[model samples]
Target: MPESLNRELLEVSAQVRGLLQDLQNLGFDEVPLAPPTAGLPRCGTAGRADGGEPGVSCRPESLEEIRADLENSPCCDLCRERGNLVFGVGDPHARLVLIGEAPGREEDETGEPFVGEAGRLLDRILSAMGLSREEVYLCNVLKCRPPGNRDPRPEEVAACRPFLERQLAAIAPEVIVTLGKCAAQALLQETTAVGELRGHWHEYRSIPVMPTYHPAYLLRNPASKREVWEDMKGVMKRLRGGGSR
Candidate 1:
């Protein structure tokens, strides 16, 4: 590796160490995590490439405990540059979860997910669905923004995977709608593109998932909004007891 890259990694490691120490100092250590139990979704390693199917280590009781657990588990280079961890926002017991790829400049600054131009479009989309931001949960596959708004690295995604699972397990949403290809593929553990995945019903830890074109994509390709609406209609039907197809 180049000297500069080595130095950068060292810096990120130091940052993680400091954060972990702070969390421990504030009494965030030795928090027990519940083992996987029967009757819930089988929380296997969706993103794991090792062909292992172990479930999530723990299922926190509430969003507060889940967030508290995350404070001590920093394990990514994004930690070095992030202003704040965009954990998530919305109802604690939401039946709907809208997940995106990751945070952008504005979200990284605000420490809230989906608060940019894309967020405005999402708000409008939510209104059309007869919902509000407070009615559903909003989050991302990756909590921190990549430097320069670039795509997230594989290591970064791995670092944040457990937190996302914990969130899903905590809220136990009835439906999940992935806003972009990245989020969909990450949760589904598939390589299929968004165009092929949208307008269909999929499963994530036994919860129903509906993939759709991202609002960011619609911003560039405005014609795709029609397709996105069609996909969301399916989600609404599922929520209204229409059942899965």
Candidate 2:
């Protein structure tokens, strides 16, 4: 056999093994193969799976639909303990989206993002940039507050990620600002420290992500506000069609 043919066969075998492994991971011991039918409608088409009556098109949900789903979701244990699910707020069509770690006590109580003292600092920062909370979309990596406002656990972040992903997809913001280490790491899928990640442009699924110090952090160390300002300037430059630093 030709060397190229042998290599292609090996690649095909690897792919097949990977598919089987994925099936196993999904709790499927075996997949029953079905013979192709001549008149069956395609999956996700406006018809039944077995080619019955026409059905509604399987399109992506709107932002409202996504929010409604999150609101009604009972999958997370955090939901049982949370006062409110702090789903994001702001313009659904905003060009920029601000992401944070999770809800704080005030946020959970008020059911709004950035409503605490840290939120006040965030407002000041936004005002300095000539923006407002209503002008940009704001959300968090986790919808529920952690016990005693501790950092989000890996399991919690994993469980909550789907909601954040759907929300981001629905909004499709041009630029994303990830506040604090946890939010930045979650969005970038990197473990780099926030101090190192800040003031640089990172990509999350093709969207530009600007990592910056969280307002809460800034409250603790007021000197770092200057650095956060510099990061915000980069975000502003991108929004205004200017080149990033």
Best-fitting candidate, measured by lDDT?
2
Task: Give stretches of model 1 more than 4 Å off.
Answer: 1-60
The CA-based lDDT of model 2 is what? 0.87
Residue pairs with backbone atoms closer than 3 Å in model 1 (clashes): none
TM-score on alpha carbons, each prediction: 0.76, 0.76
lDDT by residue (tens digit), candidate 2, 161-233: 8778778877778999999999998888889999999999999778899999999999999999899999999
lDDT of 1: 0.86
**Model 1 lDDT per residue over 106-168, tens place:** 999999998999999999999999999999999999988898988877778888877888788
For all candidates, the clash counts are: 0, 0
